[model samples]
Structures are given as structure tokens and as C-alpha cells.
Target: MLWNKKEKNKPKNISLKLYSFNEEIIFNGLLTNFPIKEELILEKTIEHFEDYDPCFFHRSVVSRWMYFEIEEYLNKIDEENKSEIKWQELPENIKKILLSDKVINRVIVEKI
Candidate 1:
């Protein structure tokens, strides 16, 4: 089945990890608190993977957050729409935050 019978009513909790040059920072919370622009990505991933009782897909979630955050920063700079922005065009501070080793590195979703 697309959805696991036992996981149908479980609460989804998300764990995020950020890795730096010398340290790793972890954040834990409900999946609802995560920022996902496309709900279909999560739903489809769950449907296709039967063993994903506790889904371990960090890159997708973090990449989404990164895109949104950068878009927000872009919007603040001007009123026109910026559908395609290049990394080199971003301001130094914005680039610094994105390039920082401390940014999110992993995401885990557990059904509890």
C-alpha cells in the first residue's frame, strides 16, 4: 500500500542537523514546523518508500529551505520578480550564510 497501516496516525517529528568544519548542531521538532514549499515532495517520497517509517531525507528539505530563504532575501532587495537568481549575484552577507558550513546538512522525519 502507499501508506503504511501502522504509520497512518503517527505524529511526524523532524530532526535537522547542521555540520560545520569542527562542530555539528542538531535541531529537533515536529515535521509541521519544517518549511516545505511543495507538500507533494514529502507525500510522494513517503508513498514510494515502504520502509520509510522514519523517513530520512535531509537534502531535499534543507534545499527547499535554502531556496525560500534566498528568495526572501532577493525580494527584500527589489520589487521585481526574481525567478532565476544566480549565486554569484547574491550579496556577500547572504552568500556567507548559505556557504557557511554550519547550514543544515541533514533532515530526519520520525513517525511517533
Candidate 2:
């Protein structure tokens, strides 16, 4: 936690080529339409992100990190709550980007 503040405040840069194609036009339009907060969340949630060129895999990395973050929070709650809680009873944010059964099993198997 010593460097939590520094890590939280770290700057991220995002850049992509703007082509004259129809796909690029639609992509740029969507980016401009989204509110700033969603954009900020995408920047903050992405971890160990390195994209030298535009790629779909970067989004996958960000999504996986988001799921991992939710899983970590769930682990904390399980440690503190002591009582069992149904997954549906959890908050919406916790259910937003759920990890698959395979991934969940992997986490458990790693602990064994």
C-alpha cells in the first residue's frame, strides 16, 4: 500500500490512427460520443497494458484485469463476512464483468 497513491495516479496514454475508412469514422464517432467518466474508467482499470499498435487483444487484457479485480474484492468479502452470500445477492458492480467458471476454478486450484 506504500505506493498506492502513486500507482493510482499514474498517467496512461492512448493513441490510434484515424483512417478515412468507414470503420474508422464510426469508431471515432463512438469515442467522441462517450462521456468522459467511462473513458477514464477504461484507462484506470487497464493493467500492465502495452499496445504498440492498435489491436483487439488490448481490450481483452483490460477486461481480464477488471474481472481479476472483482475476484480479488470478492475474496476480501469472503474473508470478512464469514457467512455465505449468494452470488445474486452481490452488488451490480460485482456482477458486471464476471469471470468464467474455468477461470474461477483455476483460482481455486492455484490455492490448493
Candidate 3:
């Protein structure tokens, strides 16, 4: 797809980490808050939170936080067996984002 200057600036990936605090918090920061969800996603082209909170970096946003290859990470979310995350359980920020469906024209298993 050909993205122009304006469109390219939009956040292509929404970063999140699992088990941030202590243990067993899969899809960690994915369900966390970021001040105000509407303000952030709207104002900024790309939102990043690698160190703001602690968690396993499941989605590789950039080279600096590259735990897994981008292709592999994207593919992982496509699989059918991806964990199911309840909508009510999601934090306000994440819930709004996912529900808005700003992701893109792709097949990403956005359960958890």
C-alpha cells in the first residue's frame, strides 16, 4: 500500500507488554492506560511506551525494542489460537483504541 506523508505518520503498531509487574499478565500494557486515550492517539503520529511501564515486549515497534522479528510478530497475531481478552477487562485506553478499530485493513487476531 502507498502511504503518503500524512498517512505514514499514523501509528502502524500499538505496543504492549505481558507480565509487567510480577508475573502472568499476558498482553500486559496492551490493556493499560496512557493518560487520555483519545488525546494521545489523535495528537501523535506514533505512540510508544517501551520503558514507561514494564512488561514483555510482544509487539516490536522499532529496532531498539526488537525482541521478535516484525514479520513473525505480525504473523503471531494472525493465528487462530491467540488468547481471548475480554472487552470489559481491557483498560479504558486500550478498549477505546481497539473498539475504534483504527488498526487497519488486515487480519490480526485482536483477542488479546
Candidate 4:
């Protein structure tokens, strides 16, 4: 989904680590929130977490969020079994980002 200019400009002051079920995509950032609507598939995830409090990054605005799309083909890894490996398999940078003491642990696992 194309992010709006206003949303892109927002500052996500908090740090976080995001990984897909198969560790296919890894996202690290200080995101304020996720988009409310994206191809309708994410509608529910957004609504479920809508009332969720925003972290130090700021209030959960439409902007200030970031995402990373992971393609299993790019990594040449098996996507069938993602939970087999431990968190250590993630990139060092992502690991460090998640290790930050101030990070907010607010993640919802959704099977798409």
C-alpha cells in the first residue's frame, strides 16, 4: 500500500523489531502505528489494535509507521515452517533494535 505523504513524515520515536511468521521479512523501527486499511485484509488487525495505546513514538496516528515486506524467494529460505528457528536467526541489526530497553512490546500475530 502506498503511504500518504503526511503519514510518511510522522516521526516514530520508539524502536521495534518485526518479523514474519517465517522470518521472511524483518522490520526495525520506531513506529507510531500501522495503517488502518490496506487491501481490506489488514482491516481487522487495525480495528483489533485500534484502541491500543501508542507507545513513546507518539499517539497512534495514520502516519509515523514503517513496514518491510519480506519475500521468501529473496532469502531462499523455506516459508512452510517459520516457527522452527529461534529469534537468534534474525539479523543482528534487528536483534539489536529489539534489544533496546525502551522498546514497547506490542505485537499481534496474524495469519494471512
Candidate 5:
């Protein structure tokens, strides 16, 4: 696939907000409790990211454009492994999010 000159020059602005209340508290209190401000915020952001898994917005859009065959792709991965596969065997976060009605309808059913 090749992009035309206009497509190549398109601007992009993507934001991923994955922070918890506890992380916000820790970040806000850094100036009063810790000497290191920027360093502490960086460390806290890393820690917060560990808790929340991030799926890129661009990837989601691209996947939808392909007819939302994500399940087929996942099944292929499981089949290639040649092991028993179940929803419980998948990542906890994936299992939880995939089972949700909103995600299912919007990203899966609607696209397919």
C-alpha cells in the first residue's frame, strides 16, 4: 500500500489518557512531599501505565478498516499455538474488555 502526497502530509494528534485517581493524588502531592518533581511524575506515570493497558487509537481505526476480523486473528494465533484455548486463558484485561457490550458492539459487530 502506498500513500499519495496529500495522505503523507496529513497531520496527526493522538492522545492516550490512562491514569488513575491514586496516581493523580501522588502526582499532585509531589511538590509537598518529595524533592524530585519531574522525576517523581515520570516514575508515577510509568507505574500508572503498568496498571492500565493501552491500545493505540490509530491501530483501532486501522483494524476496523480491515472488516474487524480481530477475533479471527486471535483464533489463528491460538490455533498456531496448538494448545487448549478459552476466554479464561486470555489476558485478564483483554477478556474483561472484550466481553463488554460497548466494545463488542462498536468495535466488533458494527465493523464486521
Candidate 6:
């Protein structure tokens, strides 16, 4: 059987495990690619979490507050210009909340 263009372009799924601050499994699913490095894994996990549900961080008080703060900040920005906001341009406190250990612990990526 020959592979078609759609098959060739299809994204591969990699096993991923996202842990909470206490090492609890927050997310377990397949990702497009496995991120090898520890930091990369964490970033990927956070990205997945955001894609799955941006409000998942609301479970914690500090995280909840930070999440709303980010929402408020984004709301104030012009709708047409909101898309131009980059992660680095966000406030340090908001960034810290997103990257905080209290919100997420670690991520493990397994190639399938």
C-alpha cells in the first residue's frame, strides 16, 4: 500500500502525562510530538492544558486570581490588537502564575 498525501501530512500522536503540583495526573493524552527536555515538556503540558481548558488553573485561589487578572488585562486590550500579544509581553506576575509549581508540577512525554 502506498501512503497518500493526507497520511504523510498527518500529525503523529505521542503519549503525554501532565502532573499537578503534588505529582497527580492532571492530563493524560496523546500530543502531536514528544517534547524531550524537561522544560520543553512542561511548556508543552501547559500549552495542552491551555488548549484543553484555560480555566483549569482556577482550582487554586492564587491561580484563580491570577487567571482573572490575565483575563481582565486581555479584555482591556483592543480586540483587533489582542492577537498581537505575545507570551513574553504578558506581565511577570501572570507569567509566574502560569509557570508556578503550585499550578503544575512536571510532564512526561513518551514516544509511541
TM-score of every model versus the real structure: 0.27, 0.33, 0.23, 0.25, 0.21, 0.32
Question: Roughly what TM-score does model 2 have, to 2 decimal places?
Answer: 0.33
Each prediction's Cα lDDT score? Answer: 0.41, 0.36, 0.34, 0.34, 0.30, 0.43
Please, what's the RMSD in Å of model 4?
14.0
- Candidate 4 segments exceeding 4 Å error: 1-66, 69-78, 102-112
Rank the candidate models, highest lDDT first.
6, 1, 2, 3, 4, 5
Task: Please provide, for model 1 over 1-112, each residue's C-alpha lDDT reduced to its tens digit, 9 standing for 90 to 100.
Answer: 1123465443223233333334454334433443443444444455555434425574355444444444345444434432233445557644543453244443222323
Candidate 3 residue pairs in clash (backbone atoms < 3 Å): none
Report the lDDT tens digits of candidate 2 across residue range 22-90: 222211222112122334345644535544442566655555455445445544654564323344455
Best by lDDT: 6
**C-alpha positional error of residue 112 in candidate 1 after TM-score superposition, expressed in Å:** 41
lDDT of 3 by residue, 41-78 (tens): 33332446434332333222332222122223433444
Give the higher-TM-score candidate: 3 or 4: 4
* Cand. 1 TM to true fold: 0.27
lDDT of 5 at 76: 48
Q: Report the number of the highest-TM-score candidate.
A: 2
Task: Name the 10 consecutive residues with the lowest summed lDDT in model 4.
Answer: 66-75
Candidate 3 residue runs with Cα over 4 Å from true position: 1-40, 45-82, 101-112
Model 4: lDDT to the true structure:
0.34
Superior candidate under lDDT, 4 versus 6: 6
- What ranking emerges by TM-score with the best candidate at the front? 2, 6, 1, 4, 3, 5
